[model samples]
Target: MSAELYDFQDKIAKIPEQEKKAFVLYDVLGYKYKEIAKIMDIKVNSVGVYIHRARTIFFEENDDSSCRSRRPMMSMVWRLVA
Candidate 1:
């Protein structure tokens, strides 16, 4: 049997502005970290921070357990682009 995936765009909506953008652009749109940095006009390193924060927030919202205790396998969750 294959595993199922779920869309978490609703969860992403709760994240801070820059982080939401970074997560959507990088994870959903398949953009590179460097590309997201260029588009956001921020440091390349900051792109990683944004993505990391976004993922953390997303997991925190999705899971009832501690976020640190269970890091979601993000690749298993898809974000719907509308």
Candidate 2:
């Protein structure tokens, strides 16, 4: 499980609007790409790309933190991108 920090909400609120919405829909809401796509009325490929971009930005911003402080769940995205 990930650390539940009160500051995480503030961190998320700081993210750009579109990416923040996508990140919350997919990660926090546990929505699948297809489900997100349908709910957002976007293409599935767009959903995937949005999530990929969001993950990249999130990881880059979190790099100064320790490994445990970064998103452990992001390893799945790295594997997919790799």
Candidate 3:
């Protein structure tokens, strides 16, 4: 993996357990929202909400105006690992 990917993974490893699991199931494992909800024992809507919140937190933590141009690529990786 690239350094950016490593950094993103490290950052995601620091988030809450539920958020990490929800994110990984949905993104990395390519599970549908309904499937993730069933697997996680949560409402389907809650799955979407958790992912949104997790994505927000990840972006906020990595925000840096000096690296604005890299945000898009980082955001893509964040989706995979968050």
Cα lDDT of model 3 by residue, 1-82, tens digit: 6777787777687768888788767655668899999999999999988876666666676566453233454466666566
- Screening candidate 2 with a backbone cut-off below 3 angstroms (N, C-alpha, C), the clashing residue pairs are none
TM-score of each: 0.65, 0.58, 0.66
Any residue pairs clashing in model 1, and if so which?
Answer: none
lDDT of 3: 0.71
User: Over the stretch 42-65, how does candidate 1's per-residue lDDT look in tens digits?
Assistant: 999999998889878877745554
| 10 residues in a row with least lDDT, candidate 2 | 64-73
TM-score, cand. 1 vs. native: 0.65
Candidate order by lDDT, highest to lowest?
3, 1, 2
Clashes of 1: 0
Superposition error at 78 for model 1 (Å): 6.3
For model 3, give the RMSD to the true fold.
5.7
* lDDT of the candidates, in the order given: 0.69, 0.63, 0.71
Worst 10 residues of 3 by lDDT: 65-74
| RMSD per model, one decimal | 6.1, 7.9, 5.7
